[model samples]
Target: MKTGDQTPLICYQEMTRASWRQFRPTTDGHVAAVSVDRRSQLALMDRRPSPSEIYYRPPAGVYWVDVSVHHAMLHLELPTAEGVFAFRAAIDVAWRISDPVRAVKDGVKLCEPIYRPFLERKLRDMSQEFEVGSFADAERHINTYFADRAVDLPSGVAMVRCIVKLAPEDSARNHIQQRTFDRHKAERRNAEHKAHLHGAELQHDWNTTAHGLAMQSLAHGQETAAVEQRHREELEQQRIAHYTSALQTGGIGVLALQLASSPADVSEVVQIMLHQKQLDLESARDVLNTLMEQRLITRRDVQDVMAPISKVIADRLNPTASLAHREPLPELAAPPVGPVGQVEESEGLDEDESDHD
Candidate 1:
């Protein structure tokens, strides 16, 4: 009540403040702790409590109370390689009126200047340093920046668990992923190139080996043919030598025949000479023995004629020469007679055939 009816000096208003409508009336002029919105000073009584916000108001007044109690969440954004990185800081503000009366005279001491968090201002200084790194590197940098250090807030507040994250757009994540894919692709290409070269080298070696085998096979065939030709030549030479030996033996037989027919006991001598030497001598010896048993010539007469023939042959031959190397007998100039003797042994022969045999 005022004194009587003198001029009334009133200060408190009855109308409600848009921001302070829900704030419970406090007794007297005692200072209280309450939250005021940045836009309209909406007290914590009316505004819904944010997930990370806390407030305490024992009494409603224009000044901060002596008790220090405040909590706030600070959000900041900075550009990064993975896009905007949102950093968070949780602050426990220690606020109070060191001088209650002076705080009232000074208005709200825990307003924007004191208890409010200037997170963007702090991050603005660090934006240039926080570059967008690689995919995981960006996340690591954000985590490390907050995890490794403490943060200070307004009103002498210390941050509790500061959390930091990178909120990238789809494009940013795609860019990082694309770079990773390109690196893997390059490595794979290099591996493929090396394998291709190795395959080429292996193919070249195979071709070279195959060519060598072919040449070796051809050379072997040619050598075999050459060996066979050499063997044939050797066989021909042997055959010629054998034929020449046979001819020499026949010549000796003919010479003996000519000697035997020399107008006396010549034919009988030739017959004996032909009978004496043959390849194996079995058949020829049989015939000679048969002729002798038939008394074609007396043994004494045969020995007389053969002894002179042997002496003549021995004089014609070289004494030092081996028999195998001896010259054949010379050709005889006798007329071609139908038969050398009238013995029945050669009676079936034709004229020319008898002479040759």
Candidate 2:
């Protein structure tokens, strides 16, 4: 019968016939047919007025069921260090079906090309450890399984959610130990470098101070030696002046004694000698006596030298007696008388003769 046109009575008869055909030993088994009125009622109910109600009704086309078939559900569990895991899978199969029925049915082969490979690949790749600690990784694995199988699963299928716990004390201890060791090493190296620099500065200051003191000592020694040499030169000059003055006084005394012993007046002799020699009395006598004893004044002799010496002294002492020693003038003769005087004298002689007689 056609879909939507069969009575309920005919639908019941078709179901019974299909069941018997599946149980029979061979294809040639006897087949019984149901009446037409019963099939028509089942077809009319499947074609309900509301589309929503139609899906709830049984199908009106030819119906069949295999009696020898059985469905099974598989359950699995996995254990790890983290936790326990569980999952389930449902599988269905058909038994003793004809070639035409098997070929026309959907999802008929249990271990078909799509399902067999998909199951094997997912089991091999399952993670032993999940560090991310979330069900997101498991969801991705299930999605990959469905994609390879060419299956469109309903929502909420193949879902996994898990919780993870960790220990906090071990992580904190490791971090503190490393930081403490690094800080001590840096401080020790810095201290050694500072000490070395301070020692070099002290040595430089000592050398500069010693050089300044040495220069000051050399300058003071030169000034002291110059002052002592000047004092010795002034003392030597005073000693030479004293010796020259004593020799001049002794020579003047000796010449005065020699002039006093001469026979001529000492003053006149000394004055004439001083005029000729152009020197003082003591110096002149010393020069003359020395010259005479040496035979150097031979042109003038000294015989009766006392006479000329006394005359020169009298001229100096009495100047008038020398002027009176000059020559006198002669007396004049009387004049004589003549004849008139002679006649008168003869007459006078006669008269004198008469008076006497």
Candidate 3:
């Protein structure tokens, strides 16, 4: 390959019509030379010449005198950055055919046997001149080789163009390697994606569990407070029950002792006063008098409590007594004697003053 830009390929006619028909008079003239070369070239052409179109096929060649020129596909072991590769190059060359009449016998192809070696050196120089991966450089170099060196061919032939390519196996191997690398990369990305989703799911579950635990702790605190409140209420009921029981069993004496400090016992004292589910007149009087002595109640409270009982007693003693409108009574002179207060009839009464004379 060359280091410069590739100019257009130069083609020349094998033999122009003017040169073919010139010098008709001469037997051993240009006609003779043109006829020999033309015979071989025509045979290689394998088609009638058309006025408007000409096609050049593989193995382009030239034959003049004893020279036989040819060009064919050339396989090369090319060193590249990727490693040594089988580079197949199709090259056009000017070649020759046997012509014993002229007694000129030299090269088999148009060039000498050293030509392939020359080309190999050129390829090596090209390998150093351009990077291995540069297809554009290699293409331009090959095209330039054909363009510039076509003038070097035998006098009858021209090279149209030339090109190079990798061998079939190397191209396939490169494609497969690329696809495999892409697949591996995609699989690794998929694995990472799944791992990311799994991590997110685990974190979500942990958060949900933590939230549930916090809610349960709050609910437990609420339940504990409710249980404490119920316990306090039960204790308060028990204390009231104790006070009521003491008052019912021991009458006014127990009530007086319980009411000694009335400020703290105000509610209990009110309950005791209002508790009349079971009572007798004697028990009522005892309770009232004790409450008065304790100063938990006034004398008026005791009188009010005893009023009904005193009226009942008076009615039994004297049915004619109108106690509803009776005056306020003084306090008892003393505690009741016997069953109740009473007076007996005297023994001497004068018998109605001796029968009234």
Candidate 4:
């Protein structure tokens, strides 16, 4: 049928038996109302209503009423969690008149008036079971409640289906979001503080370890230096002992010749000669004569060493005779060394040289 020509979901009227003649003819999608006298003898209609009869309504008659399937969408704010917050809900309610004659007797006309109050009461009762944050759970419970069991309605009406969708109200949703944000912020701050403390502890440990290593290195260095100094002192003592033994065996004259050969020990030998009280002028002259004959020392070295001692010697030995004006010291001959057999061998070498010459 055309939408404009379709029947309303509910209709009711009253008329005399003769005035009922003006009622429109019932179509395939419509149901015609019966007179009060006709209803008492009529059999009950047992067949289920058709899907296409959503807007169908029966024709008018004496004490007439008609009804069809009715669909409605409803909105409500349902309190939850003991009224701490509320959820906004949309309800799609489908209902129909199960008994037309009984519906008229019960004074039912529009389907909304009958279904709205019943749906609100059911939803409010169910909403109390959950919190605002549990909107999804609340919606599921509501859908399941209507789906699992058929609920009875007033005025001979039957329930088809009730679909419920729930969400938090604006204020309740904002409050929940703010709390979540605050909780996360606090957690992040705590984590940062813990990380900072951990980093500081690690740095402190590193510094402590570094300081320990530095102390160990310094102690090792000091120990090594002390060992090196002791080794040097031991070497110097061994060297002095060797020089003293050479002096005891070879005499001052031989030691002086040995010292003159190594120019580096010149200052040391001079110091020894100046300090030796047993060294007489004869021993000193022998040492100098051997040094000159061997060509070991320069004239400059001789002058530098003897210039100061000359005055001391001239003062002790002839005060009237100036040392520079005096005659040179007589050359002292070296005594023969080794056994008589070695001396004879040396005399044989001299004879061979004289014959060759």
lDDT of 2 by residue, 1-357 (tens): 111112221113333333333422223221122122233432222121343333343233332222122222222232212344322222221112222222223323332333334343443245334322323454355445444232321210111211222211233334334545666676777777777777777777777777777777767776676667767667545433432342345443434344344324344433433343233322533554554456454323332443554455444334334323321111111111121122234335545765797
Q: Lowest-scoring 10 consecutive residues by lDDT in candidate 3?
A: 340-349
Question: Which ranking of candidates, highest lDDT first?
Answer: 4, 3, 1, 2
Task: Name the runs in model 2 displaced over 4 angstroms.
Answer: 1-193, 240-357
Off by over 4 Å in 4: 1-42, 46-69, 82-84, 97-108, 111-118, 129-158, 167-174, 177-181, 184-188, 191-195, 198-202, 205-209, 212-357
lDDT per residue, candidate 1, 213-232, as tens digits? 99999999999999999998
Candidate 1: C-alpha RMSD to true structure equals 18.9
Q: After superposition, how far is residue 189 of candidate 2 from its true place, in Å?
A: 5.3
- Number of clashing residue pairs, candidate 4: 1
Please give me the total number of clashing residue pairs in predicted model 1: 4
Q: What is the lDDT of candidate 4?
A: 0.63
Query: Distance (Å) between predicted and true CA of 271, model 3?
Result: 6.3
Tens-digit per-residue lDDT, 1-357, candidate 3: 221112211222344543333322223322212222423432322233454322323222322332223444556655544454434445444322323222222222333343456556666556545434454466576666656444322333333334555332366358656867999999999999999999999999999999999999999999999999999889777656766786567455555555564446654454444334223545755665555445465433344544566665554344224323322233322335232221111101123333564
Q: List the global CA lDDT of all models.
A: 0.44, 0.35, 0.46, 0.63
Q: Which sequence of candidate numbers ranks them by TM-score, best first?
A: 4, 1, 3, 2
Q: How close is candidate 1 to the true structure, as a TM-score?
A: 0.35
- In candidate 4 the C-alpha lDDT for residue 266 amounts to 52
**Residue 55 local lDDT, model 3:** 30
Give the TM-scores of the predictions, in the order they appear: 0.35, 0.20, 0.30, 0.46
